[model samples]
Target chain A: MKYITHSLVILLSFLIWAGTAHAVEKTSGQSRLPVTESMVNQKFIFIGNLIKRSKTFKNIEAHGDEDVFEDIANVKALYKKAELSVQQGDYEVANNLLNEIVKLVTSITRKESKVTNDQTNSLRYYNERKATIIALMKTFDEITTNEQTANESLEPRRRMVDDFLNQAKSNITNGEVDGAIVNVDKAYDVAIRITIEVRDGITLIRELNFETAKDEYLYEIDRNDSHYFLLDITVKEKKPSAKMLLSIQKLREESDGMRADADNEAKSGNYEAATDILNKSTKNLIRAIRMGGNFIPG
Target chain B: MKSGYWLFILTICLSGSGIAASFAQEYDILHPPLGTEGIYDPENPGIEYLQQPSEALSLLPSSPTGNYVDWVKAMDDSLIEPRASIYGDQIMRAISMDVIMQQTGSMPYVRFPHYDHSLILSCTNCHTAIFLPKKDANPVNMYTILKGEFCGVCHGKVSFPLTDCFRCHSSVRDKRVLDE
Candidate 1:
């Protein structure tokens, strides 16, 4: 009993330490998306919580709907797969799988609204999954942004970027959102590689092209301001959570700052830098719209 | 017949209002056909049958369930069964059964016709999965059904709204009425 107690204390202490470390690192922003041991541990705890919540939802057991049962089984399998991926240190795959599980669980809950006797338990489960998905998305966003920044100084892998971008676009058109995301991630990875074999970098013609693209974005930002206002009104009317509203606000501010930076850089004849800033700003805006604009009707 | 004239008037009115009463009749491949009710609202007076009671059936004094029963009897079994399968298997074995719910006073008893559903869905769709094969095993209520737990799973999202009470609760307990 003494040995067991001691072991428990040690484990608890380690978890607390990890949590503290993760919080500190996040605030510090040492690396935009440093996938720490704590994040993986948190995921494991969430998975455990989900299992407990599923048990509380006795409908899955009491009811005999094959589709419902199949869905539950699929979620469980996904959770296991995510855990395995985490163990193998494949954080991206793990996170993607976790995202899938989150989407599936949330969608199921949405379809079968208030069916569970324990509404509180079901809600908690849904909220926890949503929170985890947000964390994963944030981490990926930061990683992509930071890595893209680093890759800017390298020789432009234009061909690779074009190919990946095309593939991503096609995937999106085909309604393969996950597949599109994966392709975009790959494109970013390829585009950012600072190769040792440096040829002539930042030609004048390329600079002119980037400047043109930057100007187009500036026009877009101005045009989209009206859309943003419309979205804000709609979102407010819908009475979204304070947290969602806050996220939208933060993204808008970030986009504004990036736009300003891009404008200044372009004026100073550093088109490449300006373009990069503009690109980041555009991405931030897109992410903002995607997250909050789900309520907006077509 | 007067019914034929009413049908023509209804068609003209619906077309004039620019509501696709015919277009919506096209069975959604995404959500399987469960049946619909022709809602009569004085505020919006128009023939409102989205996917149930058949496009052929007109809005008459008869209950939507009665219309559904008549439609099911006349409908080709192969048309609704062969193409659509929301739960995997396309070849669904039809089972005919009725769940007679005991309701008091003006509240009509629920006559759950498995025959109509089985035309599109298999026995495994609800049996032992959503509902047990035994009678009165599942404690079903309007509140729970509205929450998409039991019948509401298919009804509101794909089929039709539960606002039309007579659609499902069309069973008459009176011996003479039931015999007719």
Candidate 2:
């Protein structure tokens, strides 16, 4: 009974974690700024996430199309470029652009937030600030884009990777293995790493770091042809965190049905339905809680 | 020096956008730093990346021991990607929540989707502070009824009008229609 209970507990947690774990792990393409050549972690990875949902956060109050200015503007423009690339079958370009937006947004937010005055009227300049979130919402309304991808209450980095995975999977299905590999490779590197020491003699100190793996991979891509994805995948070598694997598995699970639905739905010109089915397949995944007393009022 | 560099980098990022959505909004206690125009100015108090010498230097993990620096660096290095060993409470909550989201197909909790980090405003945003930087810490309050706390704070507001009871309490037993 005890062992059965424990197994149930573990499975339940994995399902929960799995929903949040899947985000893009890798970034590819020989792309450039307005997007890249910027710091991802350095940007506001989570900035304006809530602001976008703010009722007061209007897309435009006065002089413009909300998304064409400041940081929010940059994110939208970048996301737009990425989407266009994907549409045009330029996965490499899409990869770089997306990476740029994620990094730039995250990096900029952290910097701005720390310096921001947490005032009673955080919406004082509700005009400008809110505009930022609203603009991104309009431009990149993708599944995990500004509006839909707001509740980061769960594990965010994991979701970041998961979003990437979904994007990559789309590329893979279209036989864009290079593009898919580029995307997954980024996710893999970003999500895994092995510690090493350099100086006299490079001693690979044992440590699997997500940032390291990402940096090392990014470093490689940055050095060589940014488009050439180093295809040396070994799940055993890096050993994805249970969290990541679960996310991937969940995405894979939902995708099977989603793929079929997406294909047929698109054939019918139901982009919204196609997207909804795909999103629904990946979203609302918390329902997999195998019925049992994983939750007993203690 | 380490925290200073981090702050410096952070300042540049925040000025470019908004702030405190993902990490380090603990300073919200000192509310209303300045008007948007003033802080956004190149020559303002917020402009200079205040170099408060962080005591975290000692916490920095040396060549290869176990300390705060190493932990953060490891995270920076993406070392913690695979370990998803959750606790009993986390598991229970996940199970309960997943069932709720699955059934509803659309809930405030699912709207946030975890990595939506910027949505968080306080430390108690998720766990009873269970999700801390350090793994082994005091057990976050679970059973105690928290009012206006993490999930409670926004559930009724921006996240997803949590007026619907069944949206969260999965095992509420009486599965009839909820009074909106």
Candidate 3:
């Protein structure tokens, strides 16, 4: 009878242990199922939508208006990595990557705030300076009747200066002080250079016309024409002196050489170089006119 | 409400002209055509550029000589009385209070005043939508502001921009408070 009691007691203890173990196992299994389902269903769907949004953003990035955003490559990489991470069940890492992408997108698309009272002042200053430069160019235009010389010589540089000034003003308004300063400096440098060149060209042309009687001779040199024609009607009665003719011939030779070089540069799509050469050519012709000293035949 | 009405008009004009509202809204602090005359003379030291079409000619110089706070106070004193008739009972507050911000170590303490804004805006415009009612709850930073969060929502869009540090960080004291 005692042996029977010991066996029953051992069986009861075994049953209790097995029941408790089964209960604990069921509890853990049930908890795990919900977590897995939640993660797979909710997070995966959410991540899927995020991925779609990112894909559209990527397409826009590929064909966007400008290459303003530098970190587009990094964003693409992060997006692909985020997808992989989500697939690998690393939601934490995927979430972080998504957040990073969001921040980057915001920064790229966002219009930066305008800051600094000085920006307004600087823009005004640049505009005022630009106006002055333009006025100077106009003055040069008025002094030089040669439209080609006046326009070709300084217009491109003037445009560049204007563009730089406008860009600087924009940078200032956008609070990019360093960029603004650089642009402003460039604008100032270009303006100063152009101003000097324009002034010199105008002065030389004026002096040449006053001394050479070139304008009074009714001489208009066509750039395309091989020959330089000086209408002899004005000096028909008074033939040019031998010394003046020799000076004119030498000046004509120098001018022709420059014109040839300028044509070559222009053919090579170096208009700026051509402009420079023509500017020199124009100045040389003016100088020749000055050297001739109003020669007329008696 | 008057500012809002003006903003609406501006928005309509901009939309009609096919110009971006943001582009129209963001104007230079010192507008050109600086002189009283039609000429855009930037060198003019007169207060012509400072005059808003809505306000009478200000006695203050274009570039005021006093401290920012004093200048602002003087502007308030001069204009507030005349504006009272126009505002009638619409003015939100009679006195000004400053919300001293010193949390961030990188910035000078910002003394945000209620005087200028309260005249135009009500409490509900910012209290719950942008900022918490309680003090020390909002963590204002340059990055977030640049992102158009917190003060940026109104500032960069409608109000005075966040570019001028002295505009907000006007306190004379140099107390630094570390972020918790």
Candidate 4:
């Protein structure tokens, strides 16, 4: 009887221990199964859709070169492997593969961004240089024609600038942006040099023909405004002496009065008188600017 | 006696298995055990664990105030390239016009260079919204600017601080008088 009791006690204890252990194991395994499976499925679908709809991916497809193409192909292959891993219930492997795909795509996008930015910069620089050269050419023509100073020496330089500009345009048509920029820069240099030489040359032969007094008045206004701007820049830069400052102040007051008189004349429809008064105002400003130790043409 | 012992053993075994199974079913991946819900899980993370601006902005050029990064310089230096549009491959067209604003006081006039702004922004960003295209339409004063109007909208908010005055008030005052 004692033996039977001992046997029954041992059997009961073993059954309890075994039952608990097996229940814990079964619960842990089953708990992870559904969640892992669903999560893997969702992530796979998400990444796949992301790749398909990504702007970077589309940009690469449209503009990617051979090396970029290879990188994108590798991304596709890794994505497929991640999909297979998800199907096989290997969530860990699938997650790692998906991460690799993301890294690869990120690197590709970064490279593409640089390429696009460089292209944009090149085109913008070319356009800016082109516009500057054209404006400089107009200034060169106006100064040469109005002053009639050293035309014999300037015409050749003018033709050279025109040739450079034409070359720049042709280079742009051929998709050589760097070449275009170089040509445009050369054209600008020549054109600006020609204008500066003519304006600075002491030949005071101003034969400007304006169709209307208002037109000449408008021109004088622009001239006065520019001189005023130059005077301001020079004073801040040069920091002239007190004596020079006093002289500048007196000149400035006179110029201001003249400017007011000119504006009144213009309002009263006496544009010719306004033009003369404005020109005098500009000459005073120029003298004051010179007192500040700066040399600018009036 | 043997039969009663067998019956007792059988009852204990059945009850022990039932209790163990029920306890196991109480916890799972979705329904975690009580008191363990707040614990960090490696498999699943919250949004707080993702990349934050504080960490990312450190990589860009640092500024004194307003914007943490010098965004315009960053773009110019090729440190960052932000897309101008989301729908297509659009680029910003830089306008190279300079507009001079006459000052009321003795301060130098403000020369607003459209090239700098238009290089990064679209015309619609400020036109018809913050400023009218027409001349003198927007009465931009320092008081209004300091109060977060006109240039202040971006200057003290995202671009740079307002304390740097010489940057905008660059054109000097012309102090010259004309001869009779």
Task: Go through the candidates in order and give each one's DockQ.
Answer: 0.01, 0.03, 0.01, 0.04
Stretches off by above 4 angstroms in model 4 are: A1-47, A55-73, A83-96, A99-125, A136-161, A173-178, A185-298, B1-167, B170-180
Cα lDDT tens digits for candidate 2, A113-164: 4333433223232222223322322222332333254344423544555565
The parts of candidate 2 lying over 4 Å away from their true place are A1-68, A115-298, B1-180
- Best prediction by DockQ: 4
Candidate 4 clashing pairs, residues 3+ apart or interchain? A251-B176, A251-B177, A252-B176, A252-B177, A253-B177, A254-B178, A255-B177, A255-B178
Put down candidate 1 lDDT per residue, B21-117, tens digits, no spaces: 3334335223223432223442321222223333334332222331232334344532222444567533443444455665212246677776578
Q: Rank the candidates by lDDT, best first.
A: 4, 1, 3, 2
Tens-digit per-residue lDDT, B1-180, candidate 2: 679657655654543333222112213222222242244554433332332112223323433211113333444455433233344221111110111121221222122223223212221233333232222222211111123344545443444332233334343322342111
Taken in order, the candidates have interface RMSDs of 35.2, 29.7, 36.8, 23.5
- Candidate 4 per-residue lDDT, tens place, A1-298, comes to 9898788788787777777776665445422233356667777887787788877688788998898999989989999899888878898899889879888988888887886787798888667666656655665566556656656888899999989999999998999888887897777667656755654322221123478889778767766765676677578767999999999989989999999999999999999999889978988997998899876443
- Per-candidate TM equals 0.25, 0.17, 0.24, 0.35
Q: Estimate every model's Cα lDDT from 0 to 1.
A: 0.53, 0.36, 0.52, 0.70
lDDT of 3 by residue, B72-175 (tens): 45555664343433647433332254566653222355667655655565443465456653434565655466568888897646655444446676654433
Better of 3 and 4 by DockQ: 4
RMSD of each: 37.4, 30.6, 35.0, 24.1
Question: Model 1: per-residue lDDT, tens digit, A47-165?
Answer: 65765565534544465367767888888898889888888988878877877877877766655554453455544433332333333233334444555633553324645555766
Instruction: Give me the displacement of residue A188 in model 3, in angstroms.
Output: 58
